[model samples]
Target: MNEAIALMKRHRSIRRYKSEAIPLEHVRLAVEAGQAASTSSAIQSYCVIHVTDGLKRKKLAELTGPQEQVRRAGAFFVVCGDTRRHRLLCAREGRAYEARMEAFLLAVIDATLFAQNMALALESQGYGVCYIGGLRSQLFEVERVLTPPEGVYPLFGMCAGVADESPMERPRLGAEAVLFENKYPDDESMLGMIEAYDERYARYIERREGAGRGWSGSMTKKFAEARRVDVGEYYRSKGADFS
Candidate 1:
């Protein structure tokens, strides 16, 4: 495999981090990498808030289910989908800013791509990063804390630092399962592939001796219980039509 492909394949989310501070140059490079990602219409509808305040980080950690990784990481960033900039531009040009569902979706995708680029850059620089999906747990509170102006919404948080320990590679779906041909395939074959994947994942977890829970069982339990509730209201408040 090529060097870049090898790096991409080996990429993993790192939670535990050493106490050392990340270099300033590396941080700048990571931000540059984020900016270098492709954007829709050259609008650059995204913003990255480089968070350094300890108190704010702790508060964000609390909002994100008190995840220790958020607090322990040397740096934290809140990536946002920012339509406010274009909205302002539209106002200056005497045009209406269409802040619709499709627009928001595009902005969210742009922000995610930027975040992934930054993650890859950090990894290349020997820094570890873990995305905080739980940042959406208390979305409204997070927005309030981050204080992004109207038309900007938080997509996710990323924590980065020198890793204290390595993590085991997580399993991914086989190419046969995910990569379909020109058209959609039959469900029976897909279901069979999924079953095989679940068994493979279960065996891998068992070998690690860590939780030992199968993928199907764990996923079923997670969805069946359904603890997440605040996200809906939060999205609605942000003027997103969730209906």
Candidate 2:
């Protein structure tokens, strides 16, 4: 395989890390890589806050369901979609600042692209990274941690450091399963693909014996016992428009 393909295939989320600090230069490179991602209308509506304070890290750990790896990582960064900058610019220019869903979507897309670029750059530099989606579990608390103003939303958190050990890469569904041509495929074919994927995933777990639960069984149990709540209220409080 080509080097890019090999690097993409070898990428895995690393949660555990050794007790070491990343060099300042590497951190700068990773941030620069993130900034290099394409943005909508040249409005780079994203910001990254690097958190290295121990107390802040501990608070983040608590907010993110006590994820120990977050506290142990060499650096933690919060990627946010910020419309506040544009709003301020409009104010200075005597223009109305209308925050629309499209604007919010653009900001989110820009921020996510930046985060992915940063992840790839870090991986290329022999570092490991894990995206902490659990940051959304208590999104309001995260906003307070970052002290973001209105119109700025915390999209996700990333923890980066040198990996203490290598972990197996999880398998992805076959292209036939996910890639739909000109039109969407029928459910029968999709269902068959899902079953095959579940079997493959089950076999992987069986071999590792790490989390003996099979994919289908675990997914069923998760949704069956999960409770639905209005977490969007938190986002609304932060001036996000979910309407």
Candidate 3:
């Protein structure tokens, strides 16, 4: 594999980080690389906030499932989908900016692309990084802290620093399970692939966590009931329009 590809494949989420701080210049360069990611209609509808305040980091760590990595990482960043800038542009030009489902979708995709690019860039520089989706667990509480504008909302958080530990890369589904030819595979073929992966994943879980709960079982339990159901309301509060 090529160097970049190998680097990507070696990706692991590092939770334990050293106290050493990453240079602000390095973080800026990584974010600049993130800006090079493709955006929808060149909208570039995303913003990153580096949380430097010690108090705020502790609060955010509490709000996000008490994930100490948020507080301990050398740098913490909140990635948000921002349509507020476009709204401001519209106001400047006397044009009405409409918030539609398409706008919301575009912003989300653009933000995700930007974040992944940033993560890759940081990892390439030998910094360990982890994404914090737990921010969504208490989105409203997070808002009270971050105070994003009406047209912007936090999608996730990220932590970056020198790693204190090197963890094995987690297992992933094989290409046969996820990749498709020109057409989608039949249900039986898909289920067979999943069953095979489940067995492999169970072994990995046993080795890693001392338990063997299969992937499907965990997924089923996790999704059996809707989580963060108020997320739609949270988005609506941010003035996102699905219509």
lDDT of 3 by residue, 1-243 (tens): 999899899999999999999899999999999999999889999999999999999999999999999999989999999999999999899998886988888888999999999999999998999999999999999999999988997999999999999987788988877778899999999888888889989998999889998989988999999999988899989989989
> For candidate 2, lDDT tens digit of each residue in 1-243?
998778778998999998788888998999899899899988998988889889888899889878998899988888888888999999899998877778888889999999999998899899999999778877777767778888888878999999987888787787888788898888888888888888888878877776655677877887987442435676566666755
Worst ten-residue run, lDDT, model 2? Answer: 226-235
Better of 2 and 3 by TM-score: 3
Best-to-worst order by lDDT is 3, 1, 2
Q: Estimate each model's TM-score.
A: 0.93, 0.92, 0.98
List, residue by residue over 1-243, the lDDT tens digit for candidate 1: 998888898888898988787887899999899999999888788898988888889899899988988888978989888888888899999998766777888888999989999999999998899999889888878887888777778888999999988878889878998888897769889878888889889878987785567677877888997675876667657656533
Residue pairs clashing, model 2: none
Q: Worst lDDT window (10 residues) for model 1?
A: 234-243
Alpha-carbon runs more than 4 Å astray in model 1 = 225-227, 241-243
Candidate 3: which stretches are off by over 4 Å?
none
Q: What's the residue-level lDDT of 166 in candidate 3?
A: 90
After TM-score superposition, what is the CA distance of residue 8 in candidate 2 from its true location, in Å? 1.2
Q: What lDDT does candidate 1 reach at residue 151?
A: 79
